[model samples]
Target chain A: MTTAAITVEGLRKRYGDVQAVDGVSLTVERGEFYGILGPNGAGKTTTLEITEGLRRPDEGTVRLLGESPFPRNPELLRRMGVQLQASAFFERLTAREQIRTFASLYGVPAERADAMLETVGLTEKAGTRENKLSGGQAQRLSIACALVHDPELVFLDEPTTGLDPQARRNLWDLLRAINDEGRTVVLTTHYMDEAETLCDRVAVMDHGRVLRVGAPSELVGELGAASLEDVFLQLTGREYRQ
Target chain B: MSAEAFTSLSKAMALGLLRDRTAAFFMLVFPLMFLVLFGALFKNDATARAEIVQVGRVEVFDSLPRDAREGLEEVLEIRRSDDRDEALEEVRAGDVDAVVWQEGDEVRLRYSAADRVRAGNARALVDSVVQQANIAATGQPPAYGLTTRQVEDESLKAIQFLTPGLLGWAVAMGAVFGSAFTLVNWRKKRILRRLWLAPVSAGTVIAARVGVSVALALVQTAVFLGVASVPYYGLELSGDWWLAVPLVVCGTLAFMSIGLVVGAWAKTEEAANGAAQVVILPMAFLSGAFFPLDMAPAWIQTVSGVFPLTYLNEAMQDVLSRGQSWGAALPVMGGLLLFAAVLTAVAARLFRWDDA
Candidate 1:
């Protein structure tokens, strides 16, 4: 059988008084575009971090490409790309230099790093320092760095949260192209439209639990709701925010 | 693959440090400024007067001519002591430059070798006093003469000693501040988490950071030495001066470990900076980076022994100024290594990848 890109089961995590991710489970098949949709404080980022092996789960098993992600399996790490919610770069480095540095970490060629920058439409801004880049431009550079090594699976957290409508649409196109290249793409966001537009399936999370899981349209149809927001409202017996 | 990661990370960090104007200034120009300022201030000043203590009544000194006695007193601050043992202890402890006494016709002068220049001066002044007394007694060359002995070597100057002490402080400040600020800023900006996502281990990242710090420390040493060695400053390097390279490396590691502890414990850039300053500033003063510890109180000298910078400064001075051999620096290097090992353990225990 072909292994799923990611498989997480019975995930549980707690931070002091808050249960950040309680009994969460999900799977993403190879080459699938997946989303974990939630509002603020929904534990989407925490769950993603655990799955990416950046954090250890209080209780759970996460297998990426048929290997455990925790304990830092280098084989899995080599095949996965992750972009954190916060954009980070080496200080005083220009865009080209930044991506090239990341590429070198994975033993990728500088030419490939430059190509990835171009693919993200940041070629013209390659010479600009990271601090000087616009929000959209910086985000694009971050994604370019993540994909420079061509990992088989990619994880992005809140990639479009602060962009303008124009920048957001442009990023959506770039993400779609990445998925179309047959890489398994997993993302977390609060935007209902973004989930409906990009993900083949999405897990709706609220207050540290997965409330429901399906394609956006399938979820809406199952509940006989007008939209994914209404579906969330009906599932939680409350109005959906964000 | 791991090696590649380490090399790339080190290069990137080095570039980042060089490009940050403030960091570059602290690492190079700040120390050089201290060297130039202090060198200029002491350039033309007369040598300090020697302080001597008389163990007992020396009949020869008592019989010196009135003019000769007054002249010798001008160059020597001599105090009389009844207990010969206590006077000898003071000389050994550097409380006094020399201790003088008389046995029959023999005038004896004993001086501490710790401050060779002062000891040499004290011996010369006391010998002149004895010669004048002999002439007054017989009006011809006397049968007995002044006997002088040195506790150690006699080849040091104030500037020669000052160079190593100041250089040690400069290297220490650069390593501590550089590592602490880099680690805290990286965590605040989420760069630590980003590196965590990569395939390399955290050890590799830290090793790369340490590599860059040591490289910068060596650069600081070269700059300080180059500036001080200028003919105008007249810094004379000893044969074993190259031993300072290993000593500098060990000292840098020890100080960098302190920075790591501060960085790992602080959650904000301000906290890290404050914590580093709290640790480094006092060490600079207590380690005798600005003044000789021999002149400090005994209690302060004992307290200074606890700081690794003390060992480093002492060893650097021994090799760079006092012309001591490698044997003098071995024990200090071992102490610094032990210090580095202990602090590294503490830092590892406190390390965090992110604020969360």
Candidate 2:
């Protein structure tokens, strides 16, 4: 049997006549760290959102671990974790309490909150309100909250977008450990370095379609480029800020 | 904690709100300031007869009908045969501050340059006396008819009338502020995204917020009403709060749901706050939180009924002042429920988790 964690075939969506996801298809193998790389408005988020069951695509089909991925089925939601591109929190709540509250939503024990806090190295700061946290600390707390239930699959969207270099490194390490534990992770990122280093396979998207999908080395090898950046530039043809 | 409890996400939300100090301060402390201020402002504890001259009482200056003015106890007016000469004599005698008489529709009034207070008092006294005369001539009281009699209900005190109003104000304020600020902040920070992606449903979030806001609002209502009605501190009840508290909670949910709608639809917390204030200010002012609704214009009464606050204010007045039951407040309470329903529907439809 095929062990693909996610399967998307011709997944499509439109927002007021803008074809946000145009005939895009890809497969993510189980236990693999997959990446979707694109710039703003490139449809990376829209594509990933459909896969996470947050949005219903106008056309196409999506299967997450052999189940249809829409309506956010409770069974699917229970086993999946997601860190949104912009993960807002209740500023008044202490980090630990916030995690505990979310855990209670899934009927997970409150003590699981403590374990996740420690994993994110925030046990010392667990009692602090989110508003009082330093930028890096707050982001880490958000990640801990998403991982509180220890789900089998996780989605990290622009996970390192606004983090400082040091915090970004800390996150990279944490992600590596999570992947090492054999959980499937699908992420979208603006940074090519982030994709190459953390991802096992990468899908570079442009204009609502996946232009290339392959192991990082194989994509570079095919382009005869020194790195993924060169391959990305060669494929997209516009080598500017985006 | 038991499965037998009705505790839902709403219970959790309420608990979370109670844990917040800022929410507590806005919900409880801010309104208490108004309570003390209005209480002191409205204090005629000394039987002081104070009157201010408002507009529209000037139409009766020249012609004084004998009957309406005949029964009145206090009428301060200036009688003069000459203009400048009469004005000079009045200024020296200090009997009345101003002289107002009409030559047709062009009513002329002159004031003493000496004392500002005396001038205003003199103006008000003239206005009232002339109004009384005008009414007497017509042989009618007012357009809608005026019925004036002493309320021998020795229990009707200023504080008694205000306590329930304060209770309603407190509950409504707390619920509205808490729900609005919390939802807006969550959207701004993207924390709502986590809930949208989690095993929890959006309904759970809405339920929790409503629960928390309603509970806190009810508590605030109880605290104020209890303090007022206690025998030692002046038992402010028409009866006990059994009927009042629940209706107040319903009103709280209604207002809180409106706040949530503002928060959910706004692009940011600041916008939500701004929108909430637009609604809250009118409710606070026009709903008779600071003064009696009877003091407002008739048109204001018409406008106020369109808001849940108008109903809540009316309900509080009935329960605490008139010692009425919840049945007396069904219309107003029903208005709040209607507002809550409409706001809930709109909020759910417009709520967005991501920046999109």
Candidate 3:
């Protein structure tokens, strides 16, 4: 039976003069792959972070797996995985050691680290330190770390933003495989194609509000636009972001 | 706190320290360099010597027994002064180590209390010479003899004082500045943020860092004391030197808590390093790390009383040189623990997983 993985209502956050996330509301069902798409300063990461429990909403209500997450509920954290845009690990620890360290935090054993490394195709680079990894390898290692505990829900903020096309495609397959295992995945990205390709449902956001939320084709077809990009441009205007 | 959390975190940090060349240099090499430099400078002072000026019929030098004269002249550099008052003025001003003049049949050694070690040695040498000469001339001990007294024991030289001071300074720098820089770097690199996202609590993460810091402090203390106590440095460890271990551990807790405060307050690595230096450098200088605060101005000494390093230095001196028991070192240890409790509270209040 499907249940709500996340539910938010009237979520708002203000950073001094800027309204980073304003009265945003959304819901993602369990086992669904959801995406929040927005341009720069559209509050994509801020809203995702709020939902992931890394941030506090100035005014609103949020529930992850039907429990409050604001005060850092360890039970919720144990069941969830997060890959921050700038996630980092100890530089001296090898890739395998890095996974082992985090796995140990969750009371998982060393063998799980090897399994996660193999799953991410990083088994060959397991002995390499963080500084020795390429950008793509490092990103893959981050994903492996996030999923090491076999969490029920995962949050990936711009997981493929800085990758080459090939690496991005490889990551898309990885995300699909994780979603195929019935683990709910929510990601934030400005790349329309990534949203169109990977997400079962996409929410178009601009100026701290959700302009639209539906399947990628539905979002694209509703505006009578050619593609998701055209729909985004039509909704957010043609002006370039600062 | 989970034992695995503490052990894994400390292992990672220790590995980082080993890989970081700059940290290794400061933690292991810098203190040794200071020890070698200071040791070489005072190497000759181990064998006591003196400088003396002679006045008024200094030919008494010619009449003294050859053995007594040569023995006295070996340790003392004696020079004839034509103006006795000027030579006496030199003695008063500590220009020479000592002065000797003969009155009737009595040979007098006039020495200033300043440079007490040199002055005391000079007085004893001259008294020995005069007594030997009197015995040689009359086959009897002298009726009136040269006498001099000094307030300090001859053993506590500048080197002895500096050994404890430098040891204390090394621990302070290693525990406080090292941890501050590491915490700031971890925060900047999002390592701390990653740990925060895990099941471990913030307090567990902080305790992990503290555990590593205390271990590092103990290792540094062991290395420093081992090197300093060698015959080349001639640093004597007091009979109850085991008390130094608790003193070092308490000081580590106190200073590492301050490091936590700096890490919690600083938003960047540059700011953390700067703030650490601001706290460490002034405390190092005022805490008698380089020299005793007794020679400093009264206000500076009063100011030195406020820093934990000062208490650590005094505690180190108390146990390392004076053979004081753990009971006697209570006040200094208590001061450090109080500092630890207060600063840890402050750090707990201010700590953030993200940048400030």
Q: What TM-score would every model get versus the actual structure? A: 0.84, 0.79, 0.87
* CA lDDT, candidate 3, residue B285: 92
DockQ value for model 1: 0.61
Model 2 regions more than 4 Å off: B1-23, B49-149, B227-235
Q: Least accurate stretch of 10 residues (summed lDDT) in model 1 chain B? A: B149-158
- The DockQ values of the predictions, listed in order, are 0.61, 0.30, 0.63
Each prediction's whole-model lDDT (CA): 0.88, 0.74, 0.84
Regions of candidate 3 where Cα sits further than 4 Å from its true position: B48-74, B77-140, B143-159
Quote the positional error of residue A133 for candidate 1 in Å: 0.9
Task: Indicate the worst ten consecutive residues by lDDT in candidate 3 chain A.
Answer: A84-93
Total clashing residue pairs per candidate? 0, 9, 0
Interface RMSD in angstroms for candidate 2: 3.5
Ranking by lDDT: 1, 3, 2
* The best candidate in terms of TM-score: 3
Candidate 1 lDDT (Cα, 0 to 1)? 0.88
Candidate 3 chain B: worst-modelled 10 consecutive residues by lDDT: B149-158
Candidate 1 chain A weakest lDDT stretch, 10 residues: A233-242
Candidate 2 per-residue lDDT, tens place, B157-256, comes to 6776677667677777777777777777776776676677766666566666666676676667766766555554464566634677668867977887
Error of 2 at A101 (Å): 1.8
